[model samples]
Target: MLAAVALAFDMTSVLALMYPGRERVEILGQDGVTYVYACKPGPAGETPAAQAAKAQAAFEENATKFGEAFAAELMQGIEAGAPTLGMALDMTRKTDGWAGAITAHLEKTYGCALLG
Candidate 1:
């Protein structure tokens, strides 16, 4: 029984190593905007360190795009001035509702479970 358990564990680890899936990284910008980036796994022949470096490069490249969009939106909002209480409440409600919609979209699009 012990041998069987060990073998099962070994098989699982080997499979994970063989097909180590893409990585998801979430970055919170200095301006309080959050971005999620997905990096594809490296080709089979690449060393683990090289794979990590590639992923990091991809992340940095993608972060520029995300940051620009977020900054533009934030600047637009700031230029619009403060909102009324009702407007604030309405915006809050809409953002809250969007959480569920975004989660569903991600699951449907990517076929992956989301952790809150």
Candidate 2:
């Protein structure tokens, strides 16, 4: 029975790798495990490390509900300072009831609204 189970698992792994059009979603975690959140768009050129950092920094800055692990990874992304990652982190920071802060910052810094 154990042998059969192992064989089944092996076959499933092989099939998963062989299948075409498999969507690979990257989950940024802490200690390389425990997902905090998932970002779908703007992942093409961004590394997992970068995304993790961004998420962490935003979490810290906004004191959002994101868990500790996620916040750490996001900090790494913020450190990298990649354009897409920065935008994503900023957007997330703007959320979590920080819209007022974001709007004021945008207006004060750029002379316009964050959305307008």
Best by TM-score: 1
Q: Write the per-residue lDDT of candidate 2 for residues 1-116, one digit (tens) a residue.
A: 35544443433334435433332233344445432322222335564344444554453454345345456656776677757756676657645446576445433432222111
Worst 10 residues of 1 by lDDT: 107-116
lDDT scores of the candidates, listed in order:
0.46, 0.43
**Highest-scoring model, lDDT:** 1
* TM-scores of all candidate predictions against the true structure: 0.37, 0.24
lDDT per residue, candidate 1, 3-109, as tens digits? 54444343333433433464544445444644443434344555433444443444445546655855665566667864656555755665566556654544443
Following a full C-alpha superposition, what root-mean-square deviation does model 1 have from the true structure? 11.8
Pairs with steric clashes in candidate 1: none
C-alpha root-mean-square deviation, candidate 2? 16.9
Give lDDT: candidate 1, residue 115. Answer: 28
